[model samples]
Target: MLVAYAWLTLVGFVVQLVPNAGPGALPRTLAWTVLGLGLVQCLLCTGVLHRAIDSYLGTRTVTDARLALPAVLMASMTALTVVLVAIRAVEVGLEVGLGLHGALAPFAVTFGVAVPRRTAALALSGYLAATTAALAAAGLPGADLLAALVVVGLGGLLSVFTGRSSAWYIAVIRELEEARGVQARLAVAEERLRFSRDLHDVMGRNLSAIALKSELAAQLVRRGSETEASVGQMTEVQRIAREAQSEVRAVVRGYRDVDLPTELAGARGILRAAGVDCRTDNGGSQLPAPVQAALGWVVREGATNVLRHADATWCTVWVGTDPAGRSALLVMENDGTRGQAPGGSAGSGLAGLRERLDGVGGTLRVARDGESGTFRLTAEVPLAAGNDATADEAVTDPAGTAGTHGSGTDGKDSAE
Candidate 1:
């Protein structure tokens, strides 16, 4: 825009000079000289505006000015442009000269100059005084002088208003975008806190019981009394260790796969001790990692649910390949649990299982029969969906060791 305006100023000079070039009119040599000077002033005005603006907006790196230097620099240009216009009016008619001033007025306006307030006020007052003295010295009459001051003053003020408004709005928008980024980071931190709370929920109670029982067992050993009581406390510790192991497995199996055979055997052992009589079958096949993982989580979550249920008498788990051998199907069903849990919302654990199955390009279906007091969770994953997982990375599930959860053989009246 600055360059275009400069070209426009040159074109205006040419147009006005063409018809007015003659005796008692604009001289050719003087007209050409003013024409080049006018164009240069227009470009310089544009550049000067950026000096103040770029510093204010941080769009460019600039050293801080002493404020006096900038005030003097800008105020001098204001006085110079007015004096030059008054001088040119002596050759061209005052009306044509002032018309040119109208075109050049934009150059004198400085916005966001970032100078001290007193310096700015003094600079503005100085420019007005210098302009008046220079114009009178150039022989401008009283009425012409007033007209020139009004035109230049109003044009400069108007440009300042426009440029400052734009800079203010740009600064506001930048701050809002920065605030939005901060809000997003805060939300991620909040989610991490919620995840930690879930880990606490999974492990907190079992850990407390372990601490109390271990202390009791140590006391009994020191007294050398009731040896069977110490043995029982240690046995209780073993049971809790198994439950804690399975709980951790259910909490973090989404990252990788678990062994289906190991997981099934583990679940069977846990349920039998609770008198739930759980049975599991994997169809004697080595399924893909993702498929096995999906099914493995089903067994773990199902067994945990059964052991936690008040009247879970039986549960059956099955994992098998379809007739086409292209997809693997998993189904787990248990009697009693959801009827006491209204709306079957206690089935939230199943919702997480569904999400896990979805990651392996699979689907999960759940049904609860309130009348029969039965809950069933079914899942299926495509064998080809996993894309031949990179050589089975070790998973830290309870199956981390072949029968970590099944290590305890003792039965308790109530499931931990």
Candidate 2:
């Protein structure tokens, strides 16, 4: 926008170059000088804008935000250049109406993108006053001077409104990324809590009984009674210990294993909360354990990538048998890309997914539609030879149009 506006003003000046040009006419050299200064100022304005926004978003403690040193420095340099250009216009006897607006273009972007709001109003006020004084000294009539001020002032304010609105949305995205990080950590912590509870339940009563038996054995020995009861007590303690060790191992195994249905539900809920409308279909209740585990990991990784990389508004997860029923299939797809080509994201965790699926005699394929920006990940783990018992129900609608939904964070979810 700033570039286009600057070019428009340049076109206006070029129009004045026709034969019999009025008081606004300039020598070729001064016109060239003006053009050089404009390109330089525009570059500086662009740099200042980016730096200022980075500084604003980088702030952790302040709501009003502070400008970075580079942004401030570039803005100062651009201001100096603007002054030189204004003086040159006046020296060349350019009319106030013709050249003044061009001289003020940089100020609009500088105020909108670089200046922090805390100082924007005061700075703009000072600038308007200084501009009025400069135009008066150049011998401009009062009416033309006020008109310039009005036009310049309105442009700067509009810039402030539009620029700040964009900045606000950027800030919200930063907040969403932070929130997603917290959600992942909370999921991990919740899993840990569940494991600890399982361990406690398996150990709590058995440990108490072992303690009581040991105490009884020690009391019997102190009282000089027969050793048989103590020996039997120790034997019983050994049995209980063995039982506990087995139960503890089972609990650990369960903790490490992923349940396919729970994972499908989790992926849907997570993507929904992150503002992507997600649909998931867990086609069968009885997939072989290893196939389910491998596909569960696929869902997990695919959801994470979408949250981290995509500009997606929708996602789908489908798990069931293929049409031939010789292979169990899982597919995860989304309609977003961050400039990545189909299969272009292999280095970003796709390789790991491939290795895991390979262990289960499965293959992973990624297909991308560049024109539509759709990314599809398909993982097929072959069913044991001659096994065709799994159903193709879950995949009947590849788009999951009749599937259960994982809703937006604000809305209630429902199965379709």
Lowest lDDT sum, 10 consecutive residues, model 1, at: 407-416
Model 1 agreement with the true structure over 1-416: per-residue lDDT tens digits: 33354345446533464345444333444445555455555555566666656665677533444333434443444444444444553333344334444343444344334433355446455555766677777777777777767755554454444456555666776776577567658977896776678668878998999999999999999999999999999989887877876776555543234677888998888667556788787783677666776688878787767665547888888889779988898888888654575464655787888787786778888778887888887888888765544233243234455335456332421222
Displacement of the residue 327 alpha carbon in candidate 1, Å: 18
Q: lDDT by residue for model 2 over 289-328, one digit each (tens)?
A: 7678778888888888887778788999888898887888
Tell me which residue pairs clash in candidate 2. none
Q: Candidate 2, residue 232: CA error in Å?
A: 2.3
The alpha-carbon lDDT assigned to residue 299 of candidate 2 equals 85
Superposition error at 11 for model 1 (Å)? 8.6
lDDT measured at residue 168 in model 2 versus the true structure, 0 to 100: 70
TM-score of 2: 0.66
Each prediction's total of clashing residue pairs, residues at least 3 apart in sequence or on different chains, is: 0, 0
